[model samples]
Target: MTESRTLYGYFRSSAAYRVRIALNHKGLDYTQAPVSLVKGEQQAPDYLALNPQGLVPALSDNGVLLTQSLAICEYLDEAYPDTPRLLPAEPVARARVRAIAQAIACEIHPLNNLRVLNYLKQELGVDEEARNGWYRHWVELGFAALERTLANSAGPYCFGETVTLADVCLVPQLFNARRFSVDLTPYPRLVAVGEVLERLPAFAAAHPSRQPDAPPA
Candidate 1:
């Protein structure tokens, strides 16, 4: 376990959820500093100093602060080479895994994230129904393409039998999709991959409901 690893995040934030899974999967010890997104804690001056973008997840590794979920996951994989890696050693396989991860993180997530939704509601005054429609549109569009990409996979996970960064990114996005009532029936392959990944101990431990900031049942 590394010393002084602190993750500033919101329990329900998909980006933070990704880092949580990576930390748990690598068997790393880290402390959680919950920055409640719903309560606007991420916008506070303290958090802004850590991450000027006012994002939910900003990891502090022995005071070496890092922002962006994918970058942090990659950092962990590189820093702890002895631990289970989130990326493959082979060039082609590594690129493929990153492609899947980015399809979700870059294409789908950016459109449907909390800030974008809030912008539509608070700034443009979009109605709840339209906001939900907006969410489902981007998810379905991205998942449609992602399903085709994963159709050739011979695996229980996104890339293969071995879990990679792709698997880590998929589970949290699925959780967020379900929260918005997005119909996942169109992407059975993606959904199947997600179901298998979610059952794993690390993924289960990183679930939003399992976080310390999560609401009591």
Candidate 2:
């Protein structure tokens, strides 16, 4: 039997969204403990004990704490090998998928994180328009390179037929981009891939609006 899985995450956090997708893709049963990022609940002393980084999506599996969404996804794959694998079997193929995942997770997400954007507005005195402009600039810059990369290999998903780690990461980044009103028409390949994957049962179940902590629409 699988150990009990409990995920602490915010409903709208992209990082947390990644974890939820991974878990659903693997058909894992997990409980959610919502951490309200907008309300500053992630920084509570109790939450800090689980994750010193003060980030959403800290997971506890059978009492073992894990942080960082990408790493946590890999761990789930390792721990549940019988389930659908997120990483491709070939080394080169795996590397290609990971590179795409990191392109958004590291390069795009860091600059546009809630904390970073809040700092820009609150500390640096940036106006709403300027802050949103900063968001679209980085998203467009990152997606240009990402579009070129995916155009080479994308079919129905980021890595062609298989739903790899890259697709999991891609969906959430697109979610944020749309939230910030970034133009997605420039990247048709990504939009098509997202449409295919988003319709899948796993991805559909993980949408932020479906989460327990999501605000009423």
Candidate 3:
């Protein structure tokens, strides 16, 4: 049996959302501990001890703390090989999947995370309109490249018929982009892929709306 796991995350953090999707995709049962980033709970002394970076989606598997959503997802795939695979079996295809995932996770997400936006506002004295402009600017630039990449490779999911690591990363980023009012019309391929992925039970269950810490609308 795979060991038990606990995930410390916020309901709306896209990084946390990615981990939840990966966990559900593997049908792994995990308890979620909400570390509310909005409430500043992530900076608490106890939580900081678990992850000094104060990021959401820190995973503890069999008591070993693991940070970074992509790493945690890959770790789950390795630790529970019996489950549905997240990466392609072939090395080149796996690299393709990883590259797509990183396009959103590494290239785009970092600049738009809560901390960065907060810094632009509180520390840099940017207004709400300017902060939103910064958010949309990065999303559009990243998604423009991502759209071309997905158009070349996707067949329903990012890597073809199978749901790969790329698809896991895509859904949450799109959700966040929408939150900032990023115009998604240019990326029809991404929008189409996301539409299909959103309906899957695993993806549906992991949606921000369904999280235990999800605030009422």
Q: For every model in order, what is the number of clashing pairs?
A: 0, 0, 0
> Across residues 177-198, which tens digit of lDDT does each residue of candidate 3 receive?
9988899999999999999999
Per-residue error (Å), model 1, residue 12:
0.4
The lDDT for every candidate, in the order shown, is: 0.94, 0.92, 0.94
Q: Whose lDDT is higher: candidate 2's or candidate 3's?
A: 3
Those runs of model 2 whose alpha carbons end farther than 4 Å from true positions after fitting are none
Ranking by lDDT: 1, 3, 2
lDDT of 2 at 188: 91
Model 1, span 4-80: residue lDDT tens: 99999988999999999999999999999999888898899999999999997999998899999999999999998
- Candidate 2 to native Cα RMSD, angstroms: 1.0
Instruction: State model 3's lDDT.
Output: 0.94
Model 2 compared with the native: what TM-score? 0.98
TM-score of each: 0.98, 0.98, 0.97
